[model samples]
Target: MSSISMRKTTLAAAGLAVAGTLVLTGCKDGNEEVPAAPAAPSSAASAPADGYATPPAGGASSAAPGASAGGYDGASGAPAAGGGAVATSGQSFKIGQAATIPFTSGSKSGQLALTVTSIEAGNPADLASLNVADKVKGQTPFYIHYTAKNTGTTDLSFASVGHIKGLLDGGAESGVLLIAGKFDKCPNESLPSGFTTGKTQASCAVALAPTGAKVTGAEYWGDPYNNLNKPAQKGLTWK
Candidate 1:
C-alpha cells in the first residue's frame, strides 16, 4: 500500500477502536455492577400529623397548663361521716343536694345572688366534658349546677375572683366541684353555667338585663380554686 494510504488506514483503525470501546461502555447491563444511585430520603421520618409540635426538630412542649401549681382533684371521693371534711369551713350538704350559694364582690363586697341550679356526684372523669368558651361540651356531668344572678351593681368578672364554696356531703369538700387554676383571661375548662361569655370574667356586680345592671357571671373554678387553698368569699347572707 502507498505510504499515505497506509497512514489513513492506521488512523481509521484507531478511530474504530475508540468507537468500539464507547459502544461497549454504553451497552453495560446484566451482572456488570453499576454504581447504585443515592437513596432518596423518606417522608415518614419527617414531622408527624398529631397537631403537636416535634420536640427535637425545635423544642419540647407539655400539654398541661404551665401555671398548674396548686389545685385539687374535686372527684377524689365521697365526704366523711357527719358530712364535715373541714374543706367547707364546717358547711355540709346532703348527697344530690342543691343550694343557692350567694356571693358578692366590688364596693359592697359585690353580692353574688348565686344558687346551685343542679349538683351531681362523681369522679374527675365525670367533669371531663365541662368546658368554657367551647373548649369542651357538657362532658363533665359530675358537678353541681350553680345558677347565679347578678343581684349587685357591677359586672361579674369570673377571672379576677375565684370560686368561693362547693357542694359538700357531711361538710367535706367532697361533692362535685369546679376544678382550680389561676386564669388570666376568658375561661376555658373550669367555667360555671352562669358565665355568659369567656371574653372577660363576668362581673359579680352584673345587673340583671331586666334591671339594666351589670352582674357577675358564674364560675366553676377547678381544684384548689374550688375550695382547697383559697378562702371562701363571705357572700351575702343567702338563706
Candidate 2:
C-alpha cells in the first residue's frame, strides 16, 4: 500500500504488454508470406498418360503399317509399282508340256514359265497328317507338281498357285491347296515361294480334290497383280 511500490508495479505491467505486442508482430511477419510450389509443366500435364493418340478411322493408324482398310487387297488385285503394269497374261499347258509364259502387265514384269511334270493322287494316311488334311476332307487330294522359272526383271510370286485349279472327270473345278511333297523322286524341284527375275526352274506343288478322281483339265486363275485375264489353261490330260 505504499506509493513507490504502486509505481514500480505499474511500470512492470506496461513493459510486459509491450513485449507481448512485439512477439505477436513477429508471428504475423512469419505468416505473412509463404513460397508457392512450382506449377507442373502444361504440356506434360495435358498429354495422355500413355502418350498415344487415338487411332484413325478406316483401320489406318500411323502406329500400324500395311494394314488394309477392308482387311483385303482391293478387288483390282493389283499393287502399284515398285515397278511394272497393273496386270499380266497367264499361260496354258498340257499335263507333261512346259511353256515359257510372259507376264506383260501389273506390278511384276517377267518371263515366268511353268511345266506340270507329274500329277498323282495324294495318299490319305500321309495327307491326313499334313496341314491340308483338315482342309481336304471328303475330297480326295491330288498333288500337282510343276517346274517354275522366272526370267524377267521383276519378281514373280508362285504363292499365287493356290488360285490355280483342276477340272475333275465329273467337270467339277477345284482350287489348288497347299503345296506338298507326296513321294520321293517326285521330280518336282522345291520352288521359291516367290521368284526373283532370272531364277531357274523351281519345283512346286498344289493339292486338288477327290483322290483318284482324274484331273482331266488344268487351269490357271491368273495373277491379278499382273493383270492376267487369260482363259483357263485347258485340255490338260493326265493318266
Clashes of each: 48, 12
Query: Which candidate gets the maximum lDDT versus the true structure?
Result: 2
What TM-score would candidate 1 get against the native? Answer: 0.27
Instruction: Report lDDT per candidate.
Output: 0.27, 0.40
TM-score of predicted structure 2: 0.43
Quote the lDDT for 87 in model 2. Answer: 21
Please give the distance, in angstroms, between residue 32's alpha carbon in candidate 2 and its true position after superposition. Answer: 80
Which candidate has the highest TM-score of all?
2
Residue range 110-177, candidate 1, lDDT tens digits: 32333434333333232223233132233222333344444334444432233333322222221112
Q: Pick out the ten consecutive residues of candidate 1 with the lowest summed lDDT.
A: 50-59
| Model 1, position 77: C-alpha lDDT score | 22
Q: List candidate 2 stretches off by more than 4 Å.
A: 1-92, 104-107, 131-134, 154-162, 179-198, 224-239
